[model samples]
Target: MDHHEGLRETYAGEWQGLTNSEIRARYPEEYEAWSRGEPVRRGGGELATEVADRAVPVVLDAVDKLPDNGTVVVVSHGGTIRTMIGRLLDMEPAQWERFGGLSNCCWSVMGQGARGWRLLEHNAGTLPQPVIGDET
Candidate 1:
């Protein structure tokens, strides 16, 4: 149960922890660019790809440490989780928005398949049964 600092939430720079309204008021252009899926670094912070770059390595490291059939649970912020999932699935940064918002107290699951990593579930409320792997 160790903490991994790389799993922290997306660093939004000046927009860190700001609400939507607050961000629109203070950084309207940046917010609009993000809303339009233009890949703007909100508050001049890390881009989505950058967030994935930092977070995915931590996730992969945990997976590498697991014994055969072992499970690793990751608890992280929504934006970081989403970006990491997108990278694992090999989705382009432009496609990250296709992954929906993760509501409070929800979680997502990913599984390693023979092909690669696959999303088992997303934004789920209940604790999930661990996916040993997807051999098929």
Candidate 2:
């Protein structure tokens, strides 16, 4: 998922507490452009692609430890989760931005069975609204 500077003394940095908007506003134009994937720009501090490169390995390692046909839940940030989705589903890295935001508390289910590891869901939105009495 996304990286954040933790409050722990060892993990904290001067810029750790700043939000994305703050980073964009305060940083140099090239930095912001890079972060945002602007044309011809190197982009900012870290790209989602880079994060995915690290996260997928750890996740697959953990999955390998689980029993066959077992179910696991990973509560992670949007970037991380989306990365997992793209990786598992054989989607391009850029596809994540195209899918748009993953709403808060949303989830995806992945399982390993006779068919091997697969994605059962991805960023499921809020439950569909029920029809009220007499609405029909």
Q: Residue 52 in model 1: shift from native, Å?
A: 0.8
TM-score of every candidate relative to the true structure = 0.89, 0.57
- Per-residue accuracy of model 1 over 3-120 as CA lDDT, tens digit each: 9888998888899888889999998887888998998888888899988988999989999999998998899999999999999999989999999989999989888778898898
> Residue 73's C-alpha lDDT in candidate 1?
89
Q: Which stretches of model 2 miss by more than 4 angstroms?
A: 1-44, 111-118, 125-136
List all candidate RMSDs to the true structure: 2.5, 8.6
Residue range 1-136, candidate 2, lDDT tens digits: 4233221121113345777677566666755554465532233234556656666776776667778655445666775677666776667766655554567878766654454555555667544343354122
Q: Which candidate's lDDT is highest?
A: 1
Which candidate tops TM-score?
1
Could you tell me which residue pairs clash in candidate 1?
none
Give the lowest summed-lDDT range of ten residues in model 2. 4-13
